[model samples]
Structures are given as C-alpha cells and as structure tokens.
Target: MTVERVEFENTFAVLLEDILAELPTFNIPSEGAAWVKECLEYTVPGGKMNRGLSVVDTLRSLRGEHATITPDELHKARVLGWCVEWLQAFFLVADDIMDNSKTRRGMPCWYRREKVGNIAINDAFILESCIYRLLKKYFRQDDYYVDLLDLFHETTYQTELGQLIDLLTAPEDDIDLNRFSIEKHRWIVTYKTAFYSFYLPVALAMIMNGEKREAAFTQARNILIPLGVYFQVQDDYLDCFGDPEVIGKIGTDIEDNKCSWLIVQALDRASAEQRQVLHAHYGRRSAEDVEKIKQIYCDLDLSAVYHAYEEKSYAELCALIDQADANLVPAGVFTKFVAKVYKRNK
Candidate 1:
C-alpha cells in the first residue's frame, strides 16, 4: 500500500477502536454485544473507506481560521465514520441475504454466520439503529442535530428505493438484455449507492461544521449525489473486467444478475448474435457460463466505450462543482471529497 492509503487505514482504525471502547458501556446482553463487535470488526475493515475519510478530510478543509480537530473534533469525525460504516453494514447484510452471498470482507456475511442465519434480518435492523445511537451520543446537542438525523434517513430511503428498483428491474432469474439501459443504470446507482456512499459523509461533515444546513444539503444533492453515482458506475464497469487481485473480489454481476455498467453498455451496443450470447450466458453462476458472457463483453470491446463515458461523467461532475463554487459551500471540502474517491481500485 502507498503511504497515503496507510494514513487512511490508520485513521479509520483509530475511529473504530474508539467506537468499540464506548460501545460496551451500553446496556446489552453478551450475545448482542458480541454480535455488534464482530459485525463492526469484520464488515468495516474490508472497504476502501473513501467515504469515511471524506468526512475527516472535508472537516479539515472546512476549518476556516487555522482550525484544529481536537479530541472532540476527532470524536465527531469518528462518529461520522461510524455512521458511514453503519449505513454500509445495513445494506451489505441485507444485500448478502438478497444475493445469497457467501463471503464479505474475507469473512462470512453477517446473515450467514453460524449463529445468525435468517435472524440476520433483525441483525441488519440493529446495525442500522446503531447509527442513530452514535449520532445521538455525539452530536445531539448541535443545532444541526435534527438535520443530521433527517439527512441519514432521507438518504437511506433513497438508497433502499434504488435497491428495490434494481432488484425488480433486474431479477436474478431473468437476464433479459432489454432490461439493462443507461437510464436504468443511472437510476439504480444514483439512488442505491451514491447518496449514502458519496454524499452522506460530506453532508454530515458540513452539517456539523455549522454550514447553512439547508443550503449545504442542496449543494451536496446537486454535486456529490451525481459524483456518488459516477463512483458506483465505475465499480460496476470494473467488476467484470478488472483484475481480481487489484479489485480484490472476482466479478460476479452477471451471475448475480446485477444491473451493472458493462451489461447495460453491452445491451446498448450488442448485435443480434451478441444479444443471444448475453441471454444464454448472463447471470449464470456457473464458471463456464460466466466466462462465456465475459468473452462476449470482450468481443464487443466495452471498456474503451466505458472509459470514454467515465471520463465524460467525471468531466461533467467537475464542471458542476466548479460552477457551484466552494465559496458558496466550502470548495476545498468537495475537492478533497472528489480526491478521496476519484477512482479507487479496490
């Protein structure tokens, strides 16, 4: 890992450790406490944490008068980090169940743990509830406290709507090429992944920093929301085509029938024969069928097209951010926001 990546990892570890130390003080049974600790330790360690770091980095940038992140500031950053982790945990546990996934973060999915299984539905709920608990403990007295709570809820609702649309629009059993479209892909990513993943952390920081609560949220929605969608689209594009070691997990969107970027792009460009090949091989969990679909994607040469779109999407986001002007909303904050998540490999 590069020096900067290590910096982020260390910062994230500090935040998680503080959270754990305090979590035991809450009144809970031994099993509940053990499950919470296990879920946090296992699930939170796996991702790139661009979102969580964005919170800390943006806060640093927003400090107007030689600002310092004191212990209290560090605690607030850690709390926001906890929120990002909580949001991810909520989605991933449910997603594992929905996808029937076996592993996550190099460990078993929470839903599939030997003691958990189907009871994971409630486990997901508990994970989500922890976000509010952390928020209430850390930022409840701030004037923006209610706004922070509302922001998480609204963003979560948006993501769940996107997830529902994704599941309905692209059912696992049916891999119809017609269902995949750029428009649908945009919707799925914007609502399902970006708002919570990209915008929420920054918005949380902005709110805590005492920026115009309403205006900051509006600005975040306008810019970070689209940026977030762009981030997820790149992930979908990378899944089938990216290197396993570089991207970490092997691509399985086809087998999972995920409405991913490449499949939609292929559907948009496929010839008649290519269409048949997709119908036959798409979403096949079998290794051979997965390879066959990947071959067809290679035949179509989707990466070049995807790269062009990625560049254009990024350019568009930059233009919007430039036009929005950080003076109106702390430009440095969004600059770091984009930097943290511009194009992560894993």
Candidate 2:
C-alpha cells in the first residue's frame, strides 16, 4: 500500500515540474518573460497538488490500469491537472491582497514581489487565460470539449461569487464581528474553496470519460461539493488548534479579519461578556490579542462543537457517496481519497 502511495505521490511531483517547465516555453523568451516564468512557477508549485492527482487517480480507479487510456487521453488529463493548479494560483494571488496576507505556502505572495506588487492582479489574469488556452490546445477536439469549457466557466463564476460574498461580509474597512455568520461562512467556502478545489478536478475527469454534461455535473456535485465543504471546514478547524509543524504553516484566520468556522460557531453560542471579548480582540495579530480571543473560544467550548460537526459531516457524506454507484464513477475512489482529508487535523 505504501509503495503504491509513494509511487503515486512521486509521479505527481514530476508532473508538477513538467507543468512548470512547460509554462516558460509558452512565453516569447524575452527579458521580463523570465519573471513571468518565475511568477507562474512559484505561484503554481507550492499548493498541495492533491487536486491534480485526484483527476488522474480517479480516472485510473474508474477505468482500471488494464484499460487503454490513450496517450492523448493521458496528456489531456495532465493538462487538465495544470488547469486546477492555475485556478488555485488565481485565487491565492487575489486572496493574499484581500487578507493582507504577506506570505502564502511559506513564501512571499505574488503581490509582494519587487517588480510585481499590485501587478500580480494582471499576472493572475494571465494564469487564468492559460487554462483556456491549454484546454483549447489539447481537449478541443474531444467530444466533451465544450462541456469541459462550460464547466470551467461556471466553476470560476461560482468561486468568484463566494469570494465576493466573503469580501463584502468581512470588509477590511469595517471590522464588525456581527457580520460573520455560520451560514455565510459555509456559503463562502462552498463556492470559493469547495467548488474549484474539490469538484472541479473530478468533474474534469468525468467530462473526459465522455459522461453526459448533466450527469458529470450531477455526480461531481453529489460528492465533490460536500467534499469541498468538508475540506474547508477542516482547514478552519486546523487554523487555531492545529500543529503548525504538521500543517506546514501557521494559522492566521483570526488576525486577518477573515470569516472562519470557529469564530462563527463561537458567536452563535457566546455569552454577552464573551461576545464583547471576541468583538474587541477577534482580528488582532498581536500575541496578547490572539491569546485573548483563543481564551474566549476555549471558554465557549467551540472545539467540541467543531468536532461534532466534523463527525456528522463525515457520516452524512459517507452515506451520500455510498448511495452513488461505483459503476458510474467509482464511489470507492473518492471515498478512499477524501476519507483521510476529512479526518485529518493538519
């Protein structure tokens, strides 16, 4: 099991390198083109490439190793994997600006670079355009090409909707804790993180498999949407209570005035004094302020509530996924894959 897992992971790493290398060749090979290469490389590489791997792995699990996935089919899947990575880069570049985040994935964000700064927004647009170019270049001849294109468009729109709601609900100019809600948090994550991160890749795989447009969307939503939500909620849970060494980064959702599951849940159950404490200290970055907020959340017993939610969500998702026939797309594939993610603390 470990050997197979290692082989899968290693193959993914090489694929990432090739994707990065391939980006440079697309440029005109000029002076500033070098940094375009660098920007894309750094922004694209740092993400957990689980989304990309899920596409190929899901395809394999569905079609089986013995089935002949043509070299063209494999090429398109790899290219679609790059699209997922590009989508993440688009979000991260913009998100850093909104969160006032100085770093991402343990390095300086695109917006903070010497010649980049606010220009990262333009770079983000470039990253986004590459996705369509690649899709057209590789998958346009396939029967499912139009469906894949439409899925990417709709998925991007939904993510932008989630981001808009999130930004408006928690504006930097206004630090009001009253605006944050459990309902809003879930909605924000569902559209923003869940759709693109969870559903998009699997949807891409299904589209490539020549699944009907409606059916592909249906199957991806039945599992991937919930999987996306579960993934984001686990991220929120991990922020304050997680081991940074294991997660590979420190959590800062509180300090950033961002909407997170923990604060919203705590808000729903906080006493007047506890609410006041949170209202005063919620978005502060200082150790003293963060410590105070942590104390209040601890007093509220929100950790227990979060754990309850996690277990319940896991059970619900498991049931829904089980009801989905493996014959359509292999429920066992995502079930086995997402189970670890759903249960992980880091």
Candidate 3:
C-alpha cells in the first residue's frame, strides 16, 4: 500500500478504538461490548474502503489542493467516511442474508459464520444504529448535523426500497425474465447502489464544507448517480466475467436469480429460442443449469456488449463532468470519483 493509504488505514483503527471506548456509556456488559467490537472489526473495515475513503477525498477536492485542513477537520472527515462504511456494512449484512450469499470480501458471509446465523439480522440493525451514534457524537454541535442525519436516513430508505424492488422482481423460486428489463435494472442499480455508494459520500463532504445550495446538490446528484449506476453495471458485468479470486467473492448473480444487468441485456438481445434456453436455466441452482446459462451468455456475446456499454457510459460521464459548474463544486470532485471506478476490477 502507498504511504497515504497506510495512514488512512491507521486512522480506521483509531476510529474503531474510539467507537469501542464509548460502548460502556451504553451500559452494555463487557462480553456484549467485546462482541460488538468483534463485529465492527469484521464488518466495517474489511472492504476495499473506497466508499469510506471517498468522503475525505471529496472534501479535499471540494476545498481545492491549496486549502489547509486542520487535524481536527481531517479526523472528522475520516469519521464521517467510516460512517458511510458502517451504512454499507449494515446493508450488506442484511443483503447477504436475503440473497443467501456464502461469502463477501472472500470471507464467509457474517451471517454464515458459526454462531452468527440469523442474529446477523439484528447485527445489521446495530451496524446502522452505529452510523447515527457516530454522527451524533462527532457532528451534533455542527450546523449540518441535521442534514447529515437526514441524508443518511434518506439514503438508507432509498437503498432499502431498491432492495425491495430487486427481491420482488427476482425471487429465487420465481424465474421469470419477463419481470427483468433495462429500466428495472437501472432502477435497482440507481437506488440500491448508486445513491449510497456514489452520492452519499460526496454529499456528506459537500455538506461538511458548507455547500448548502440545492442547485449544487442537484448537479452533483445528476452526475454522481449516473456514475454510480455505471459502476454497478460494471459490477454486474464483473460478477459474471471477472475472476472470483480477483473480485473477492464467487459470482452468484445467475444462480441466485438476481435481476442482473447481463441477464437483462441477454434478454434484450436473445432469440426466441435463446430466450427459451434462458428461461429454462437462468435461476436454477444446479451446476449444470448454471453452466447452461453461462453458455447462453457467452453465445449471446454479452461480454462485448458490456464493453460497448462501458465505453459509452464512461464518455457520457466525462461529458457531464466537462459541463459541470466549477463554481458550485469543483469538477475534480466528480472526476476523481469517475477515475476510481471507471474500469475497476473489484
């Protein structure tokens, strides 16, 4: 890792210590506190941390290169960044349960770990509650405290709604491609992944930097949401085409009956007979059936189609950034985000 990344990771350890130090105020017993600590260690800091680190990066971008960030200010930004990470952990814990996932970040899903099981449902809630707790502790006296709370709350609701759409559209027992579409895929990606993954971190940074203009937020959302959608589309593509060892988990989108981007694209381009083949094997858990679906995806040349879409989306994002108003928020904020995930493998 680079020196800066090492420093950022060191701060993560500090923040975790700070969070655990305060658990006694909640009157929890020692064992419960230790469990929470273990849970936080396992869930909060394990990912690539792009979402968490983006808050600090965005703040720096908004402030410009020459601006000075006080140590306290930098610490607060890191805390807010981890709050975003906490929110993600909360969602993923529950999502893994709902998706019946086996692994995450290459480790066994928390719910699948011995003794975690269904208690992970409540653990997810605890992960969410920690976001507010950290917010209140760190930002309660700031003018934007309410804004932070509202932003997190709204993002959570939007994500949950998106998850609902996904679950309703692609229930494991129900294998109906009729329910999948480009529009639905976009909706699911936008709400479930885009808002939290892309918009929330930058929005938090903007708010912290005191950019309260609604138009500024509107502009950021217009760019960042699409950017997020593109990132997720890449994720969908990678789940099928990228190496599981590289991406950190096995691709279960097909076997799990996910309304994935590849599936929708295949449906869009499938022949009548190919459609029959997909409908036959798309959601089956059997290895043979899964291979059948993969064969169909390969036959349909979804990989080339994905590459085409990737190029188009990247160009559109660049155009949007080029046209963004520099006065409201620096174009570089969006540019940095775009660069991070443009052709990401994980």
**Top candidate when judged by lDDT against the true structure:** 3
Query: Model 3: which ten-residue window has the lowest total lDDT?
Result: 2-11
lDDT by residue for model 3 (79-197), tens: 98899999999999999999898889999999998998998999999999988878888999999999999999999999999999999999998778899999999999999999999
Clashes of each: 2, 0, 0
lDDT of 3: 0.91
TM-scores for all predictions: 0.89, 0.89, 0.98
Q: How many backbone clashes can be found in candidate 2?
A: 0
Off by over 4 Å in 3: none
User: 152-232, model 2: which lDDT tens digit per residue?
Assistant: 999999999999998888775678988999888989999989889888888888778877757646776878888788889
What value does the lDDT take at residue 14 in candidate 3?
A: 81
Looking at model 2, residue 319 earns an lDDT score of 85
Question: All models: lDDT?
Answer: 0.78, 0.79, 0.91
Backbone clashes in model 1, listed as residue pairs? 254-283, 326-331
